[model samples]
Target: MSIENPQPLSINSMAALVTLGKFLEEDQWFPQLLENKRIYRVTYSGKNGQFVCFAQIMNKTSIIMCMEETYESKVQW
Candidate 1:
């Protein structure tokens, strides 16, 4: 799905997106969402513990909607 009014991503989210974008730029293999817009799942470790980041890639830009999973639920990408 296309973003209607894509807002500015948070500082942390922007940093994560930038890191993933760099990786995608180097490999040229960004994640492609099936039936949905292109999506990417980035896993990282922090002070708290391990975490997963989910984002949507559009026009070479990554839009992160949510951070770590709050509860057990199947992610549609």
Candidate 2:
């Protein structure tokens, strides 16, 4: 779950990125385009709960990630 980029990321952020990459690579996620930006969506059910994630790679520099747990959890972006 480690990113080989210069940007710093927290442990949880790294894990999320790894999950996003895996889903994308496996062609298991949906991609949307908005204002010429490509956003990826990953949705699945985990042991803890149902999870949905949105990730947008911005300017090839940083990632904007959002996740919502469908188990009485607040959304994080």
Would you list the clashing residue pairs of candidate 2? none
- Cα deviation of 6 in candidate 2 (Å)? 24
- Model 1 scores worst on lDDT over the 10 consecutive residues at 29-38
- lDDT string, candidate 1, 1-77, tens digits: 33555555566665665677677557754443333324575566554556766667445454676576544354333
Which parts of model 2 have CA positions greater than 4 angstroms off? 1-23, 27-37, 69-77
- Please count the clashing residue pairs in each candidate, in the order shown: 0, 0
Which candidate number would show the highest TM-score if scored against the true structure?
A: 2
lDDT tens per residue, model 2, 1-77: 22334345456655665666676767855544333224566666656667677776533344756576354454433
